[model samples]
Target: KKRYKAQPIVLAIPRGGVVVGYQVAKELGCPLDIIVPRKIGAPHDPEYAIGAVAQDGSMVLDQKVVKSLGISSSYLEEAKKREIEEIERRMKMYRKNLSEPQIVGKTAIIVDDGIATGSTIKAAILSVKKKNPALLVVAVPVGAPDSIAAIKTLIYDIVVLATSYSFAAGGQFSQNLVQTSDQEVIGLLQKASGPQ
Candidate 1:
Protein backbone atom coordinates (compact mmCIF):
# COMPACT_ATOMS: atom_id res chain seq x y z
CA LYS A 1 0.00 0.00 0.00
CA LYS A 2 3.05 2.30 0.12
CA ARG A 3 2.49 3.01 -3.58
CA TYR A 4 -0.89 4.43 -2.56
CA LYS A 5 0.52 6.10 0.58
CA ALA A 6 -1.56 4.06 2.98
CA GLN A 7 -0.14 4.97 6.39
CA PRO A 8 -1.47 1.92 8.16
CA ILE A 9 -0.52 0.26 11.44
CA VAL A 10 0.08 -3.50 11.46
CA LEU A 11 -1.01 -5.74 14.30
CA ALA A 12 0.47 -9.21 14.04
CA ILE A 13 -0.70 -12.29 15.88
CA PRO A 14 2.40 -13.56 17.60
CA ARG A 15 4.20 -16.97 17.53
CA GLY A 16 3.40 -17.26 13.80
CA GLY A 17 2.13 -13.93 12.52
CA VAL A 18 5.28 -12.20 13.73
CA VAL A 19 7.14 -13.50 10.70
CA VAL A 20 4.28 -13.09 8.23
CA GLY A 21 3.34 -9.65 9.59
CA TYR A 22 6.92 -8.41 9.45
CA GLN A 23 6.85 -8.68 5.67
CA VAL A 24 3.57 -6.77 5.41
CA ALA A 25 4.63 -3.92 7.68
CA LYS A 26 7.95 -3.57 5.89
CA GLU A 27 6.15 -3.37 2.58
CA LEU A 28 3.53 -0.88 3.84
CA GLY A 29 6.04 1.36 5.63
CA CYS A 30 4.01 1.31 8.82
CA PRO A 31 4.70 0.73 12.48
CA LEU A 32 4.51 -2.87 13.63
CA ASP A 33 2.86 -4.13 16.83
CA ILE A 34 1.84 -7.51 18.19
CA ILE A 35 -1.42 -9.07 19.36
CA VAL A 36 -0.69 -12.27 21.20
CA PRO A 37 -3.54 -14.75 21.57
CA ARG A 38 -3.29 -18.08 23.29
CA LYS A 39 -5.43 -21.03 22.31
CA ILE A 40 -7.10 -22.65 25.30
CA GLY A 41 -6.93 -26.30 24.33
CA ALA A 42 -9.21 -28.90 25.78
CA PRO A 43 -8.01 -31.60 28.20
CA HIS A 44 -6.20 -34.55 26.57
CA ASP A 45 -6.33 -32.71 23.24
CA PRO A 46 -4.08 -29.81 24.05
CA GLU A 47 -3.41 -29.03 20.39
CA TYR A 48 -7.12 -28.71 19.67
CA ALA A 49 -8.25 -25.23 20.55
CA ILE A 50 -11.58 -24.77 22.28
CA GLY A 51 -11.15 -21.00 22.62
CA ALA A 52 -8.64 -18.20 22.52
CA VAL A 53 -7.42 -15.38 24.80
CA ALA A 54 -6.31 -11.98 23.54
CA GLN A 55 -3.59 -9.80 24.96
CA ASP A 56 -6.10 -7.44 26.56
CA GLY A 57 -7.64 -10.24 28.65
CA SER A 58 -10.59 -10.71 26.34
CA MET A 59 -11.47 -14.28 25.38
CA VAL A 60 -13.79 -16.27 23.07
CA LEU A 61 -14.64 -19.93 23.20
CA ASP A 62 -16.29 -22.50 20.95
CA GLN A 63 -19.29 -23.11 23.14
CA LYS A 64 -20.60 -25.90 20.96
CA VAL A 65 -17.34 -27.81 21.10
CA VAL A 66 -16.97 -27.08 24.78
CA LYS A 67 -20.39 -28.52 25.47
CA SER A 68 -19.89 -31.47 23.19
CA LEU A 69 -16.60 -32.35 24.84
CA GLY A 70 -18.02 -31.86 28.29
CA ILE A 71 -15.37 -29.32 29.18
CA SER A 72 -16.18 -27.37 32.29
CA SER A 73 -16.44 -23.60 32.55
CA SER A 74 -13.95 -23.71 35.40
CA TYR A 75 -11.55 -25.54 33.15
CA LEU A 76 -11.77 -22.80 30.57
CA GLU A 77 -11.44 -20.17 33.28
CA GLU A 78 -8.21 -21.71 34.48
CA ALA A 79 -6.85 -21.83 30.97
CA LYS A 80 -7.85 -18.22 30.34
CA LYS A 81 -6.10 -17.12 33.52
CA ARG A 82 -2.85 -18.69 32.45
CA GLU A 83 -3.21 -17.33 28.94
CA ILE A 84 -3.86 -13.80 30.23
CA GLU A 85 -0.78 -13.98 32.40
CA GLU A 86 1.26 -14.81 29.32
CA ILE A 87 -0.38 -11.99 27.40
CA GLU A 88 0.56 -9.48 30.11
CA ARG A 89 4.10 -10.81 30.20
CA ARG A 90 4.40 -10.70 26.42
CA MET A 91 3.06 -7.15 26.24
CA LYS A 92 5.76 -6.01 28.65
CA MET A 93 8.46 -7.83 26.72
CA TYR A 94 7.18 -6.81 23.28
CA ARG A 95 5.92 -3.22 23.49
CA LYS A 96 6.32 -2.02 27.09
CA ASN A 97 3.83 0.93 26.87
CA LEU A 98 2.99 1.36 23.21
CA SER A 99 -0.55 2.59 24.09
CA GLU A 100 -2.30 -0.28 22.23
CA PRO A 101 -2.73 1.39 18.84
CA GLN A 102 -5.95 3.36 18.37
CA ILE A 103 -7.91 1.59 15.66
CA VAL A 104 -11.17 3.53 16.04
CA GLY A 105 -10.48 5.85 13.11
CA LYS A 106 -7.59 4.12 11.41
CA THR A 107 -7.13 1.25 8.99
CA ALA A 108 -6.37 -1.69 11.26
CA ILE A 109 -5.12 -4.83 9.59
CA ILE A 110 -4.71 -8.13 11.39
CA VAL A 111 -2.07 -10.57 10.15
CA ASP A 112 -1.37 -14.20 10.83
CA ASP A 113 1.01 -16.82 9.42
CA GLY A 114 -1.71 -19.36 8.66
CA ILE A 115 -5.14 -20.47 9.74
CA ALA A 116 -6.21 -24.04 10.47
CA THR A 117 -9.39 -23.99 12.47
CA GLY A 118 -9.58 -20.17 12.34
CA SER A 119 -10.86 -20.00 15.90
CA THR A 120 -8.06 -17.73 17.12
CA ILE A 121 -8.31 -15.55 14.03
CA LYS A 122 -12.04 -15.16 14.60
CA ALA A 123 -11.43 -14.17 18.18
CA ALA A 124 -8.82 -11.68 17.03
CA ILE A 125 -11.27 -10.17 14.56
CA LEU A 126 -13.94 -9.97 17.26
CA SER A 127 -11.52 -8.38 19.70
CA VAL A 128 -10.53 -5.70 17.17
CA LYS A 129 -14.14 -4.99 16.24
CA LYS A 130 -14.77 -3.85 19.80
CA LYS A 131 -12.34 -0.99 19.11
CA ASN A 132 -14.45 0.16 16.12
CA PRO A 133 -11.75 0.68 13.56
CA ALA A 134 -12.46 2.55 10.34
CA LEU A 135 -11.59 -0.60 8.43
CA LEU A 136 -10.80 -4.17 9.39
CA VAL A 137 -8.82 -6.47 7.11
CA VAL A 138 -7.84 -10.06 7.71
CA ALA A 139 -4.65 -10.90 5.80
CA VAL A 140 -3.04 -14.26 5.75
CA PRO A 141 -0.74 -16.18 3.39
CA VAL A 142 -2.53 -19.47 3.90
CA GLY A 143 -5.52 -21.06 5.65
CA ALA A 144 -7.77 -24.08 5.66
CA PRO A 145 -10.90 -23.88 3.54
CA ASP A 146 -13.38 -24.73 6.27
CA SER A 147 -11.79 -22.34 8.74
CA ILE A 148 -11.81 -19.53 6.21
CA ALA A 149 -15.41 -20.30 5.35
CA ALA A 150 -16.39 -20.11 8.99
CA ILE A 151 -14.92 -16.62 9.32
CA LYS A 152 -16.09 -15.11 6.00
CA THR A 153 -18.72 -13.04 7.79
CA LEU A 154 -16.49 -11.80 10.60
CA ILE A 155 -14.39 -9.20 8.79
CA TYR A 156 -14.83 -6.30 6.41
CA ASP A 157 -12.13 -7.54 4.04
CA ILE A 158 -9.94 -10.56 3.48
CA VAL A 159 -6.64 -10.78 1.60
CA VAL A 160 -5.15 -14.14 0.92
CA LEU A 161 -2.35 -15.04 -1.48
CA ALA A 162 -3.09 -18.69 -1.96
CA THR A 163 -6.40 -20.50 -1.56
CA SER A 164 -7.44 -24.14 -1.87
CA TYR A 165 -11.03 -25.17 -1.57
CA SER A 166 -9.94 -28.63 -0.46
CA PHE A 167 -7.26 -27.77 2.02
CA ALA A 168 -6.42 -30.41 4.56
CA ALA A 169 -4.37 -28.18 6.84
CA GLY A 170 -2.40 -24.94 6.76
CA GLY A 171 1.07 -26.49 6.70
CA GLN A 172 0.45 -29.05 3.98
CA PHE A 173 1.00 -26.45 1.29
CA SER A 174 4.28 -25.22 2.78
CA GLN A 175 7.59 -26.89 2.18
CA ASN A 176 9.48 -25.22 5.01
CA LEU A 177 6.99 -26.00 7.69
CA VAL A 178 9.08 -25.62 10.81
CA GLN A 179 8.72 -23.76 14.08
CA THR A 180 10.08 -20.23 14.50
CA SER A 181 11.93 -18.93 17.53
CA ASP A 182 11.10 -15.97 19.77
CA GLN A 183 14.42 -14.29 19.07
CA GLU A 184 13.76 -14.51 15.34
CA VAL A 185 10.34 -12.99 15.89
CA ILE A 186 11.81 -10.06 17.83
CA GLY A 187 14.41 -9.47 15.18
CA LEU A 188 11.84 -9.47 12.37
CA LEU A 189 9.61 -7.05 14.28
CA GLN A 190 12.53 -4.71 14.83
CA LYS A 191 13.49 -4.82 11.16
CA ALA A 192 9.92 -4.11 10.05
CA SER A 193 9.62 -1.11 12.39
CA GLY A 194 12.27 0.65 10.34
CA PRO A 195 10.94 2.83 7.51
CA GLN A 196 13.02 1.26 4.77
Candidate 2:
Protein backbone atom coordinates (compact mmCIF):
# COMPACT_ATOMS: atom_id res chain seq x y z
CA LYS A 1 0.00 0.00 0.00
CA LYS A 2 2.73 2.52 -0.98
CA ARG A 3 -0.10 4.94 -1.60
CA TYR A 4 -0.07 5.23 2.20
CA LYS A 5 3.53 4.07 2.68
CA ALA A 6 4.29 6.71 5.28
CA GLN A 7 1.75 4.95 7.57
CA PRO A 8 -0.50 1.94 7.24
CA ILE A 9 -2.54 -0.43 9.39
CA VAL A 10 -2.89 -4.18 8.99
CA LEU A 11 -5.72 -6.17 10.51
CA ALA A 12 -5.67 -9.92 10.15
CA ILE A 13 -8.66 -12.14 10.59
CA PRO A 14 -7.47 -14.41 13.34
CA ARG A 15 -6.92 -18.16 13.48
CA GLY A 16 -6.32 -18.76 9.76
CA GLY A 17 -5.77 -15.13 8.87
CA VAL A 18 -3.14 -14.68 11.55
CA VAL A 19 -0.51 -16.52 9.54
CA VAL A 20 -1.25 -14.59 6.37
CA GLY A 21 -1.57 -11.30 8.23
CA TYR A 22 1.74 -11.89 9.97
CA GLN A 23 3.52 -11.91 6.64
CA VAL A 24 1.59 -8.88 5.32
CA ALA A 25 2.17 -6.73 8.38
CA LYS A 26 5.81 -7.78 8.54
CA GLU A 27 6.24 -6.67 4.95
CA LEU A 28 4.33 -3.41 5.49
CA GLY A 29 6.13 -2.61 8.75
CA CYS A 30 2.80 -2.21 10.53
CA PRO A 31 1.62 -3.67 13.81
CA LEU A 32 -0.75 -6.59 13.42
CA ASP A 33 -4.12 -6.96 15.12
CA ILE A 34 -6.66 -9.76 14.84
CA ILE A 35 -10.38 -9.52 14.10
CA VAL A 36 -11.84 -12.83 15.27
CA PRO A 37 -15.27 -13.73 13.94
CA ARG A 38 -16.82 -17.18 14.33
CA LYS A 39 -18.78 -18.62 11.45
CA ILE A 40 -22.33 -19.75 12.22
CA GLY A 41 -22.52 -23.01 10.32
CA ALA A 42 -25.56 -24.60 8.78
CA PRO A 43 -27.42 -27.08 10.91
CA HIS A 44 -25.89 -30.56 10.56
CA ASP A 45 -23.17 -29.14 8.31
CA PRO A 46 -20.64 -27.73 10.71
CA GLU A 47 -17.88 -27.45 8.13
CA TYR A 48 -20.01 -25.30 5.86
CA ALA A 49 -20.11 -21.60 6.67
CA ILE A 50 -23.49 -19.88 6.53
CA GLY A 51 -22.79 -16.70 8.46
CA ALA A 52 -20.47 -15.15 11.03
CA VAL A 53 -20.42 -13.11 14.27
CA ALA A 54 -18.01 -10.44 15.43
CA GLN A 55 -16.82 -9.93 19.00
CA ASP A 56 -19.00 -6.87 19.58
CA GLY A 57 -22.28 -8.73 18.99
CA SER A 58 -22.23 -7.98 15.27
CA MET A 59 -23.70 -10.73 13.09
CA VAL A 60 -24.28 -11.28 9.37
CA LEU A 61 -26.48 -14.00 7.87
CA ASP A 62 -26.39 -15.75 4.53
CA GLN A 63 -29.96 -15.16 3.43
CA LYS A 64 -29.62 -16.95 0.10
CA VAL A 65 -28.20 -20.06 1.72
CA VAL A 66 -30.67 -19.91 4.60
CA LYS A 67 -33.54 -19.70 2.16
CA SER A 68 -32.23 -22.49 0.00
CA LEU A 69 -31.68 -24.64 3.07
CA GLY A 70 -35.13 -23.67 4.40
CA ILE A 71 -33.76 -22.92 7.84
CA SER A 72 -36.36 -21.47 10.17
CA SER A 73 -36.07 -18.09 11.83
CA SER A 74 -35.81 -19.72 15.22
CA TYR A 75 -33.05 -21.96 13.97
CA LEU A 76 -31.14 -18.95 12.62
CA GLU A 77 -31.66 -16.99 15.81
CA GLU A 78 -30.48 -19.89 17.91
CA ALA A 79 -27.42 -20.23 15.76
CA LYS A 80 -26.68 -16.54 16.24
CA LYS A 81 -26.96 -16.92 20.01
CA ARG A 82 -24.51 -19.82 20.01
CA GLU A 83 -22.05 -17.90 17.85
CA ILE A 84 -22.39 -14.77 19.95
CA GLU A 85 -21.53 -16.80 23.00
CA GLU A 86 -18.47 -18.02 21.18
CA ILE A 87 -17.63 -14.46 20.22
CA GLU A 88 -17.82 -13.40 23.84
CA ARG A 89 -15.75 -16.32 25.02
CA ARG A 90 -13.05 -15.64 22.47
CA MET A 91 -13.11 -11.91 23.14
CA LYS A 92 -12.51 -12.53 26.81
CA MET A 93 -9.76 -15.00 26.10
CA TYR A 94 -7.92 -13.32 23.23
CA ARG A 95 -8.78 -9.65 23.70
CA LYS A 96 -9.01 -9.09 27.41
CA ASN A 97 -6.83 -6.28 28.75
CA LEU A 98 -5.82 -5.46 25.22
CA SER A 99 -7.07 -2.18 23.83
CA GLU A 100 -8.61 -2.46 20.40
CA PRO A 101 -7.01 -0.72 17.40
CA GLN A 102 -8.14 2.68 16.20
CA ILE A 103 -8.87 2.54 12.48
CA VAL A 104 -10.46 5.95 11.98
CA GLY A 105 -8.81 7.99 9.20
CA LYS A 106 -6.09 5.42 8.62
CA THR A 107 -5.52 3.13 5.66
CA ALA A 108 -6.34 -0.43 6.80
CA ILE A 109 -5.64 -3.76 5.21
CA ILE A 110 -7.54 -6.89 6.31
CA VAL A 111 -5.78 -10.16 5.63
CA ASP A 112 -6.96 -13.75 5.67
CA ASP A 113 -5.50 -17.06 4.55
CA GLY A 114 -8.23 -17.39 1.95
CA ILE A 115 -11.82 -16.57 1.29
CA ALA A 116 -14.16 -19.52 1.00
CA THR A 117 -17.72 -18.18 1.34
CA GLY A 118 -16.64 -14.57 1.94
CA SER A 119 -18.95 -14.51 4.95
CA THR A 120 -16.11 -14.19 7.45
CA ILE A 121 -14.37 -11.50 5.43
CA LYS A 122 -17.65 -9.67 5.01
CA ALA A 123 -18.14 -9.67 8.74
CA ALA A 124 -14.57 -8.49 9.27
CA ILE A 125 -14.99 -5.67 6.76
CA LEU A 126 -18.28 -4.56 8.24
CA SER A 127 -16.82 -4.55 11.72
CA VAL A 128 -13.85 -2.56 10.54
CA LYS A 129 -16.05 -0.12 8.68
CA LYS A 130 -17.73 0.80 11.93
CA LYS A 131 -14.39 2.21 13.02
CA ASN A 132 -14.42 4.66 10.08
CA PRO A 133 -11.13 3.81 8.42
CA ALA A 134 -9.91 6.19 5.71
CA LEU A 135 -9.60 3.25 3.34
CA LEU A 136 -10.00 -0.51 3.65
CA VAL A 137 -7.99 -2.93 1.52
CA VAL A 138 -8.37 -6.70 1.68
CA ALA A 139 -5.44 -9.01 1.02
CA VAL A 140 -5.43 -12.78 0.79
CA PRO A 141 -2.89 -15.20 -0.64
CA VAL A 142 -5.42 -17.50 -2.25
CA GLY A 143 -9.18 -17.74 -2.62
CA ALA A 144 -11.86 -19.39 -4.73
CA PRO A 145 -12.71 -17.49 -7.87
CA ASP A 146 -16.28 -16.72 -6.93
CA SER A 147 -15.34 -15.79 -3.39
CA ILE A 148 -12.56 -13.51 -4.55
CA ALA A 149 -14.80 -11.88 -7.08
CA ALA A 150 -17.65 -11.39 -4.61
CA ILE A 151 -15.42 -9.74 -2.03
CA LYS A 152 -14.11 -6.99 -4.32
CA THR A 153 -17.48 -5.25 -4.36
CA LEU A 154 -17.59 -5.08 -0.58
CA ILE A 155 -14.27 -3.34 0.08
CA TYR A 156 -12.45 -0.36 -1.39
CA ASP A 157 -9.71 -2.62 -2.81
CA ILE A 158 -8.67 -6.27 -2.70
CA VAL A 159 -5.48 -8.16 -3.49
CA VAL A 160 -5.78 -11.87 -4.09
CA LEU A 161 -2.79 -13.86 -5.38
CA ALA A 162 -4.75 -16.72 -6.89
CA THR A 163 -8.18 -16.42 -8.43
CA SER A 164 -7.90 -19.65 -10.45
CA TYR A 165 -11.67 -19.92 -11.20
CA SER A 166 -11.27 -23.73 -11.23
CA PHE A 167 -13.14 -23.91 -7.93
CA ALA A 168 -11.98 -26.16 -5.06
CA ALA A 169 -11.51 -26.11 -1.31
CA GLY A 170 -9.18 -23.41 0.10
CA GLY A 171 -6.75 -26.02 1.37
CA GLN A 172 -6.45 -27.59 -2.05
CA PHE A 173 -4.12 -24.77 -3.08
CA SER A 174 -1.80 -25.44 -0.15
CA GLN A 175 0.83 -28.19 -0.06
CA ASN A 176 0.61 -28.87 3.66
CA LEU A 177 -2.37 -27.24 5.35
CA VAL A 178 -3.20 -28.50 8.83
CA GLN A 179 -5.70 -27.57 11.47
CA THR A 180 -4.30 -24.73 13.58
CA SER A 181 -4.43 -24.96 17.33
CA ASP A 182 -5.64 -22.17 19.61
CA GLN A 183 -2.30 -22.29 21.33
CA GLU A 184 -0.61 -21.26 18.10
CA VAL A 185 -2.85 -18.23 17.62
CA ILE A 186 -2.18 -17.03 21.15
CA GLY A 187 1.52 -17.42 20.64
CA LEU A 188 1.47 -15.39 17.42
CA LEU A 189 -0.49 -12.53 18.98
CA GLN A 190 1.80 -12.43 21.97
CA LYS A 191 4.82 -12.29 19.75
CA ALA A 192 3.38 -9.46 17.64
CA SER A 193 2.96 -7.20 20.62
CA GLY A 194 5.81 -7.16 23.09
CA PRO A 195 5.08 -8.47 26.61
CA GLN A 196 1.36 -7.82 26.41
Best by TM-score: 2
Q: Which stretches of candidate 2 lie above 4 Å from their native place? A: 167-169
Positional deviation of residue 51's Cα in model 1 after best superposition, in angstroms? 1.5
Give a tens-digit lDDT track for model 1, residues 105-168. Answer: 6677889988877777877887788888777788899877777777777776788887776554
Candidate 2, 181: how far from true, in Å? 2.0
- lDDT of candidate 2 over 1-196, digit per residue (tens): 5777335678887677888887788787787788877788889897787788776657778889989999898987788788778777776676556677778888889988888778888888888889888888999888887888788887788988877665354667764887666677667766777642
- Report RMSD (Å) for each prediction in the order shown: 2.5, 2.3
Residue pairs whose backbone atoms clash in candidate 2:
none
Q: Flag regions of model 1 displaced more than 4 Å.
A: 2-7, 96-99, 165-169
Clashes of each: 0, 0
C-alpha lDDT of residue 7 in model 1: 47
TM-score of 1: 0.87
